[model samples]
Target: MRSNAARNALSGCLGFALIVLAGFNAAPARAQDQLKVAIGQINNWENQAPTLGQDAGIFKRHNLVLENV
Candidate 1:
């Protein structure tokens, strides 16, 4: 029927859209993308994790740049 054809066409369009969205979501980040984290009014063990993780090379290994402020 015409309604069945229309439904199939719509389903195909939706499937293509989902594939395009998945491709966009899977795109990799650039190497120079740095994350800036602000620690206001307090600088202690709790606030020092980002810097510590950066120093430990964990962030670099995961392609993340942590900028603590």
Candidate 2:
């Protein structure tokens, strides 16, 4: 039981790390200087953050072209 708990904890930590790394790898805006992002809908917070960020000039500050289609 103790070994199983340790393995589970290790896996959980690794999974969290994987997600963080993936997020970093997914957004390489500086390398391109421009990006075309497409969202299916903007009816929720998940779809709203980017729009708000763009409206707030955050994406332009970072030299990105985040568009919702």
Candidate 3:
């Protein structure tokens, strides 16, 4: 036979565990797909390099979208 205190403690722990499990199961799914890129420094000659490649359709040829930021 279990004591009343032990039974109450066990029930409290089980309820908390169930609440935690329910929270984990109820996570959001639909997240945005965005890439964060950064460029340190820019050179005058190389500044338009990406633009030249883009104008020449090199990015399209390689299946890439190079956004300058």
Candidate 4:
């Protein structure tokens, strides 16, 4: 009787895991929107941070895309 209970518990756990995995897999991929932004100054080194942020994925994390001129 105990073995039957254990088997049922295991099956239930597996079923729950499968459902969670399926939910994750069925979710749609989110496409990040690319932004076109203009910075007033390109001649100065102070403008480097925005360029670095975009290149290092920091801007994407904050949902920003910068275009400097």
Candidate 5:
């Protein structure tokens, strides 16, 4: 059997998670939304896909705003 402290901690965590989820669910929705992202490449070879994706406007189509670091 679990100790009382352990059980209390677990229940507290579960309750906090539930409240956070409910808060998100109660928030208003936006019609147009974009998420900012930064893409970094280790070398020239790794940079090809994002470059091509930017040229192809694939990220814009998916409502993602990518940035380089």
Candidate 6:
């Protein structure tokens, strides 16, 4: 029927739109992307893990730049 054709056309358009939107967000980050970590304002050893790891060059070995905030 004509209504079935119309429905199929709408669904095809919607599916195409979803695929395009997904493609936009599916791109991987470039190598060594700086990642911002939210460490609480607590100035304790537990909260300094990211900073310590960064200083020790642990994240650098894994191609990650940690920015603790």
Instruction: Please give the lDDT score for candidate 3.
Output: 0.72
Pairs in steric clash, model 1:
none
Please write out the lDDT profile of model 1 over residues 1-69, one tens digit for every residue: 479889999999999999999998996756656899997554578777787888899988888887777
Best by lDDT: 6
Candidate 3 off by > 4 Å: 29-69
The deviation in Å at residue 60 for candidate 5 is 39
TM-score of each predicted structure versus truth: 0.47, 0.45, 0.41, 0.50, 0.39, 0.50
Q: Cα lDDT for residue 37, model 5?
A: 49
> Number of clashes in every candidate structure?
0, 0, 0, 0, 0, 0
Candidate number with the higher TM-score (3 or 6): 6
Error of 1 at 31 (Å): 2.5
Q: What lDDT score goes with residue 22 in model 6?
A: 93
Error of 1 at 65 (Å): 0.7
Question: Which tens-of-lDDT digit does each residue in 1-69 have in candidate 5?
Answer: 999999999999999999999998995754545555456664677766766786799977776666645
TM-score of 5: 0.39
How many backbone collisions does model 2 have? 0
Whole-model lDDT per candidate:
0.83, 0.79, 0.72, 0.79, 0.74, 0.87
Candidate 2 colliding pairs = none
Give the lDDT of residue 16 in candidate 3: 100
Put the candidates in TM-score order, highest first. Answer: 4, 6, 1, 2, 3, 5
What is candidate 2's lDDT per residue for 1-69, written digit by digit as tens? 479889999999999999998988895545526666777566877878877898999878777777566
Q: Against the true structure, candidate 1 has what lDDT?
A: 0.83
- Model 5: C-alpha RMSD to truth? 11.0
